[model samples]
Target chain A: SQQGEEDPQALSIQEGENATMNCSYKTSINNLQWYRQNSGRGLVHLILIRSNEREKHSGRLRVTLDTSKKSSSLLITASRAADTASYFCARSPSGNTPLVFGKGTRLSVIA
Target chain B: DVKVTQSSRYLVKRTGEKVFLECVQDMDHENMFWYRQDPGLGLRLIYFSYDVKMKEKGDIPEGYSVSREKKERFSLILESASTNQTSMYLCASSLLGGTNEKLFFGSGTQLSVL
Candidate 1:
């Protein structure tokens, strides 16, 4: 069974709009990573947030971790048409364990 | 930059036929993984290897097997392909034993089983 589950399976917005996606996990994790997949293809790593950290930023990507709530969110600021893709959240339990992925949220940014 | 390459971009085979998906990494990373991606199901781990000749089953390992003859290569094999087995297969590699290790992935192979 998948340990992580993402909410809002799909989202659509204008190119300049901001998009946010949320994910919830069932277990404690060492880290949570976000990935982007274009047209249901291979995934590209976006950002990773450690369990102890409340938030992180990488370019236009921002990720927040609320361990007390077992939840996390990814916010893409000033979305671009190129940003249209599926986003997934993967959790690594403890250390050195394979990541467990959520179903994912598909974001479509219209230009 | 790390490069994880899959042998084919697409593959088609009849039911009950043997199928093999190959992955190679140029970064000399110690860990490699194979996963299948399906619509609404996300990516599910089929197998992974930490070193040469070492293999471990992931969440979904049924009807699947893996071979890691060398550290740079990992292969996923299906003894008999089934219609339900048709999906996008992805390969990834990362540094060994890091809590915050990020996975580098290949472009993926879309396999179709008739």
Candidate 2:
């Protein structure tokens, strides 16, 4: 079974608008990572948040993790048409375990 | 820069025929993984290797096997291809023993079984 479930399976917004996607997991994790995939290509690592950390930022990307709720959210501010892609949330139970990815949320930023 | 490469961009094989999907990583990472992506099912792990010649079964390993004879190369084998087994196969590698390390993925191989 997949450890994480991402909400809003799909989202669409205009350029310059903010986009947010949420993920909920089933068990304890050492860390959570987010990835972005363009059509017909490999996934690109976006950011990772450790269990002890509440939030992280990378450029226009912001991620928040709430261990108490076993959930995380990825926010992309001032979205652009080039930001259109599929976003996935992956969870690692521990340092030794491989990541288990959710189905993903598809975001389309219209120009 | 880390680069993971899958040998094929697309493959087609008939039912009952054996198939092989190869992946190679340039970063010499200690952990390598194989996953199959299906619509609505996400990416399901088929196998992984933490070291050369070592293999571990993952979430969905039926009808599939893996090999990692060298540190930089990993191979996934389908004993006998079936139509139901068709999907996009992805390969990834990550540094060992890092709690928050991110995986580097290959471009993926789309396999079709007739």
Candidate 3:
């Protein structure tokens, strides 16, 4: 079963606009990571926020984790056409367990 | 550069036929995984191996099996292919014992079951 559930199944925005995606999981996690997948391709790791860390940033990507609410959010600033892809959030329950991925959010950045 | 290579970019197999998808990672990572990507379902783990000759079933392992005879190689087998099993298969590898280690993924294999 999937541990995380991503909100806003699809999002459309202009190239210069910002995009936000949210994820909610059932159980506690050691960390949360976000990934992006282009059409017909594999996933690429974006950023990871540990349970202890409230927020993290990589380039224009920002990730925030809230353990109390068991949820996380990803924000992509200044979206571009190349940024159009499916974004997923994965949760690791512990160091020994494999990461469980959410369904994902499809983001379309119009040029 | 870290690389995970899938043997095939595209494949077509008839229903009930046996199919094998191979993956090799050059990073010498201790963990390997097989996942299937569908249109609306995102990615679902099929199987994973933490070490050579060790395997574990994931959430959707039915009708599928895996083999990991070597540390850097993982093979996903479809015992009997079905139309419903047609999807994009991805292979990934990661180091062990890290709470937030990033996974390196292959380009993916698009399999079609007729």
Collision count for each candidate, in order: 0, 0, 0
- Evaluation by lDDT, superior candidate among 2 and 3: 2
Rank the models by lDDT, top first.
2, 1, 3
For A1-111, candidate 3 gives per-residue lDDT tens digits of 655999999999999999999999988888899999998888999988888999999999999999999999999999999999999999988657788889899999999
Question: Cα miss at B94, model 1 (Å)?
Answer: 0.6
DockQ of each: 0.71, 0.69, 0.63
Reported per model, the fraction of native interface contacts reproduced equals: 0.76, 0.70, 0.61
Question: What interface RMSD does each of the candidate structures achieve?
Answer: 1.8, 1.8, 1.9
Candidate with the larger DockQ of 1 and 2: 1
Q: Which residue pairs clash in candidate 2?
A: none
User: How close is chain B to the truth by TM-score, in each candidate?
Assistant: 0.96, 0.96, 0.97
Sorted by DockQ (best first), the order is 1, 2, 3
DockQ of 1: 0.71
In model 1, where do residues sit more than 4 Å from their true spots?
none
Per-residue lDDT for B6-29 in model 3, tens only? 999999999999999999999989
> Candidate 2 regions off by >4 Å?
B98-100
Q: Model 1 over residues B43-78: C-alpha lDDT tens digits?
A: 999998888999999999999999999889999999
